[model samples]
Target: MISLKKNEKWFWSGVVFIEMILFYSSSMTYKQQTSVPFLERYLRNKPLAGSLKHFGFNYGGKYQSIENDGYFHFVEFFVRKGAHFGTYLALGVLLCLALYTYFQKNNFLKILVPWLMATGLAAFDEFHQGLTGGRTPSVVDVILDSAGAFTGTLLVVVIVYFILRHKNMKKT
Candidate 1:
């Protein structure tokens, strides 16, 4: 039996909640998944479209035109990948934070454990997607997810380093 400090308990609870959310989202059907991108496209066409177009995003594929056809599938592809990256990025950050908080004395464990956990989750996520009817799980996606996780963890490390540097400077 392991007893957790109050903050540790809260962090672990949050991590579990995030995992549930990700799992639930992964369980959505193909058609159900499209709904979010559809809504995003609709909203982008509204006033926001102009701002995005100015930045050369053009969801309609007019700016850089990654795909010639104006079909929403082209936009949806990028949107989906972006979602994968963003979600895993968040997962990585949260996991790193939790591990860092719990293992303040072990600096190596703080980084290594979170990366391993995030990598494992990314692999599991792709495997779960493979079981879904409309989803085709790919190793490429796992790579992307792992990349996002690493990016997030690296960001945390950089931020923490800066903070510690600032704190040490203040003492001088």
Candidate 2:
């Protein structure tokens, strides 16, 4: 596989900006339907319609049958309801961007700055939605969104550390 590119903060920022925006929006949609038969209800509703469930279908018709496999079912279920899936995807992209910037020493302020910004931004988005006619603000969604950033950041740290160690080993 090809190695990650260096100092691609601008690239990552744009991607994170877009992905997290969708993540934040999908999260709001997910939050709006969190209750008994949450996924089923939301999947039937507009904006987050049943069509979104297709994302988890990497193997076409076979994987489309979420009922047969536990993991695939959960994946489809989340695609059908939870915000965690979007959270993880956006955060993973953010982490890649973060690593590129960090290595280039261009990640100004502190490393946690992006993470905090993402969390705060999502919280703000939810707050903004609260101002709308039918939308409501949710603290739970913000927490989950922040946790996504942490999960991604932690993964990046561990993976990068191991990669560096392996490179040093190869030189010895």
Candidate 3:
């Protein structure tokens, strides 16, 4: 596990957030053969090894195949490509991060802030892809993006409950 510094939660969360969006972006950005070298490069790097292994664990085991026959399809007409499950995993983490950050924020607006922020980020990414020579934006991608934000937000609330419960127990 990567040692997370107390102040690095946002950074890690942003990384996950961007990567989740990039999942579909990269699919639109490159052909299958072209994407393999990058994955190879990532796998050979040590810091990424743990993440790589985890991806495989989530993907397949023992015999690692280059072909990602997993539920998330890399090929899509637009940026909304891939399995909804990948979105679930990443959004779950990001939401946990948001909820942690919002615990003491105390305004009802605090609840909407993360959702809006994620929506804007996802929208911007799709817009960026649309401007790119090879890609175009899709309403489906926007919807999926919102779905990811929703999933993330839900995760945060659940985690906060556990954290608070644990804290209460400790104090008792």
Candidate 2 lDDT tens digits, 1-172: 0245544655467656766565455446434643435544654543433554344453322454333543334444445334543564366446545555444453332236656766776677667767655565667667766777666655665666688789989999
The alpha-carbon deviation from the true structure for residue 94 of candidate 1, after best TM-score superposition, in angstroms, is 0.8
Q: Give per-model TM-scores.
A: 0.74, 0.54, 0.52
Q: Candidate 1: global Cα-lDDT? A: 0.70
lDDT of 3 at 143: 66
lDDT of 1 by residue, 75-170 (tens): 556678798788778877778776776676776777678877988998887788788888877777787788888877778766876887898899
Candidate 3 regions with alpha-carbon error over 4 angstroms: 1-5, 9-13, 16-80, 83-92, 95-99, 102-110
TM-score order of candidates, top first: 1, 2, 3
Best by lDDT: 1
**Pairs that collide, model 2:** none
Order candidates by lDDT, high to low.
1, 2, 3
RMSD of 2: 10.6
Name every residue pair that clashes in candidate 3.
Answer: 72-83, 95-152
* lDDT: worst 10-residue window of model 2: 58-67
| Candidate 1 vs 2: which has more lDDT | 1
